[model samples]
Target: MRDRIDEEITFRKLEVLLAFMETGNLSKAAEALNVSTVSVHRALHSLEQGVRCALFRHEGRNLKSTEAAQMLADVAQEVLALMSDGIRATRDAAGYSSDRLRIGSLYSLTINTVPGIVVDLKVRRPALQVELALGSNAELLDKLKQGTVDAALMAVPETEPEVDALPLFEDDIFFAAPANSPYAKLEAVDLRDCRDETFVSLGEGFVTYHGFVEAFRVADFTPNVTMKVGDIFSLMNLVSGGVGYTLLPGRVRGVFGDKVQFIPLRPQYLMRQTIGVSFLRARERDPNLLALMAVCRLRTRSVG
Candidate 1:
């Protein structure tokens, strides 16, 4: 076998040689590879010296490839192609699904945020089939930990050692009531004064539920929750039909338009939900998750 230190022909040099062979000119090869002409010339000269052969000869002001160079280029092409296939296979064996990506999200996000991200991701990866699973924050996080989904779009959890989170935006919690309710006319609603009012809330395990409980806790009283629903749409329907008041994130303000009114909460009772995408720290380098993270970063910049 050849000595380790004697191996000088690298993949990068072969790539430059292939570019020069394809373009047939130093400046053109440099333009194709986005490198300077001097860099390309140096790489080709270094490659010729490493192989200890005359791979090119001067023809007027240009360099022409020899028959040996043509044979080496053919072998280089096959070697590079095989290396790429091996890499993809290795990633697949390591649990990186190249053809499909599973994503978890909240029911409330289906209105706008989820769709926007999905569309942008699709644009970036047209051949990728995306599967969306909708549930509460706890449900999605559980699915993420279980590996049932690649990543989750929800309220970022406070303490998850194995999960990596990228916050996209922050939404404030609002006091929701029926459009015709007396509370709708107020500039802001204080939880302390609404202690006697019956309320509907999302069930436990939802981020909104946690926010609701904490806000009331800060106000020094427990809310008179008469009913607990599993999803935000149902809770919105209850509030719209005059069932009872509920708390909601500002993102859902336009969902029920004229049917439900979302009012700002008093300063003391205020809460803000940090919405984001989360995935396993181990899978953070997975190509699909990387693309999702890139899209999330773009969304964060746009939202901000």
Candidate 2:
């Protein structure tokens, strides 16, 4: 029988091993993890000790995975994935079992769509509570995928195998610039009119970015991004600051003061993004989430 180490192992230790496998060298692994080589080395050693065998064979500062470790890598990934799934399910239950509903959204939705829906829902369910999580579309989608959120209002991706989305409303993108910015000078800006202009872009995980990218793609062009920020509000602020032009929604203008101006797009290269609620496939069976979805649909359509 194989012997287990006296001490217990942890998720962090397994994560370190995954990092090591991705990059065979400890230094590189630590670099990827933003940790010191010594810390990573210690973690690997701890994992090896717990498993009662050498996972990696090292010679002259070079590390090579043994056959056992290679086999275990697949198991490690599965275990980690399952652990994440379990944690999310538990957390979702905790979040939902209470009076509160954990909701997530893309930056654009946060500005008007989510607020409007939430306010309306609050009026109807005065006893209910809400917790908001904001981020890029990808971030929210990842959360919804894992059952970390009761629901999310955002744009559907080009494709998601696991997600079941109900379309709330489809809205077009706008060419919104600061009131006095150069892009606002156009009498009517064509899709290709701002070809060489610098755009203030949304950071990763945004459905706005996805829609913006698709607009450019349909125009057969790419944006010259001068800046990328984590939230759309920041992009609007930068636009009002006259940093650069940004592609945004008409509703986004409501959030800014007179300092910002947005123009209606020609929509020649248009892709209308849908704002809707998404939840885990399993949770669709839940009465609470489904009940929440109905409120979401009503609020999104009537949202001002």
lDDT (C-alpha) at residue 217 in model 1: 94
Compared to the true structure, candidate 1 yields what TM-score?
Answer: 0.71
* Consecutive 10-residue window with the lowest summed lDDT within model 2: 91-100
Model 2: residues with Cα > 4 Å off, grouped in runs: 1-98, 182-187, 300-304
lDDT for position 173 in model 1: 97
Off by over 4 Å in 1: 1-95
Q: Write out the backbone clash pairs for model 1.
A: none
Query: What is the alpha-carbon lDDT of model 2 when measured against the actual structure?
Result: 0.77
Q: Each prediction's Cα lDDT score? A: 0.91, 0.77
The digit string of per-residue lDDT tens for model 1 on 133-252 reads: 999999999999998888999999988999989998899999999988888788999888988999999989899999999999988998888999999999999999989999999999
TM-score, every prediction: 0.71, 0.63
How many clashes (backbone N, Cα, C below 3 Å) per candidate? 0, 2
